[model samples]
Target: MFHVLGALVFTLVGVRDATWTTDGMAAALLVAGSIGVAGNVAYGFDSVHVALGDTSLVDQAGAAVLIKPLGLFFPLTMLLCAVAVRHVAPRWAAVVIGLSALAFPVANIGNIPALGVAVGVATVVGFGALAMRPVRSPSPATPAASAAG
Candidate 1:
């Protein structure tokens, strides 16, 4: 249900952007939405395995590790946009990313709108701060350390 809605949102956004002059952001959104739809499809197919306890521990561990990062992708992408594109407004990018992050957890947990908005606002603020930070370069090691045997 939520997955379907997300897919629709992505598809619509992609279509909307196609008419504009924006480079690839809309395409990326469409792809992300498609991935979300696919993820939900895979999740649905796994129901039998989940019910029968037929899955492996390794698979479960890998899935658990993947989940957190999967959830973080939206926020991360917004941050990347802020850093990579000079024209994009960081605040708006952050808001969209935040909304996406908010939507997933809330939708997964069966809550909608409220949590979605909250997560969206919070994520935007957090990432916005991150966007403002200056890029730092790694320091060169001393010659003494470089010459060590």
Candidate 2:
């Protein structure tokens, strides 16, 4: 769900000025979001199979297989945008983005999904900031008036 929202935000931001970094992030989110949706379906399917007294056909690993790639894509998404934000955003934002990028992959590693969720919220906020940031354009050169001799 978060990634889906992110994709929309990035797409809207892209309308202002498209960049390879932003466009690539949006594409990654789209792909990862699709995988997430399918993983969710697999999760539900596993549950249904268990409820129907037919656990033999369900591979518990299937859900993990589909969902675990998010551990890769989420951070990739964050870091990619982080590179763009590193210069434009405030120092604190840059620090947060960097730490978020490094920490996200491990947030859920130790059964700390609460931490993962918190990081996820931060990711959303970080992305929102990126999307809302005003674009930077080169300033036009103005010739100084020549002093009379």
Candidate 3:
């Protein structure tokens, strides 16, 4: 996930260097990366808590009233990544951003660990493509616009 966020930052920087001069998009990328890193760390802690079978955080209502806030940030961070990527690289962006968007639902719905892995992989590859330099070649004219013949 962090790798995905990092790729997003690279994409934003690449697009800005090529198209516009706005720092807002670049800043957004950094912010999203920071948030994603933090959220994933928190999620790791939460998973540990669950593994330990420590349900003390939740009440009899079967609600994790305490950990809910921390968990919420993870999805929100992912959403930020999606929005930023979509705005910067709309082309081929869906391959990554779409998978990321489905990560949360897929994780919770089917409880499939592979879904999250796939999303991360897609993000890295998609954004990596965005960072590639455009292919260019000199005009097929002679020396001097064909030597101004």
Top of the candidates by lDDT: 2
Off by over 4 Å in 3: 1-38, 49-64, 108-110, 130-149
Residue 25 in model 2: lDDT: 48
Q: Per-residue lDDT tens digits of candidate 3, residues 1-149? A: 44335434543443332232125544554555455445445455545666798643433244444344544444444455554444335446634655665576566446688876776677556645555634222233423123334
Estimate the overall C-alpha local distance difference test score of candidate 2: 0.51
Q: Scored by CA lDDT, what does every candidate get?
A: 0.44, 0.51, 0.49
Whole-structure CA lDDT of model 3: 0.49
Encode model 2's per-residue lDDT on 1-149: one tens digit a residue.
Answer: 44444445544433322242345544554565444444434444545666788762234455455545533554555565565445455546656766776787688446478887877677666656655666443223211112111
What lDDT score goes with residue 46 in model 2? 47
Quality of model 1 by C-alpha lDDT: 0.44
TM-score, model 3 to reference: 0.47
**TM-scores of the models, in the order given:** 0.33, 0.49, 0.47
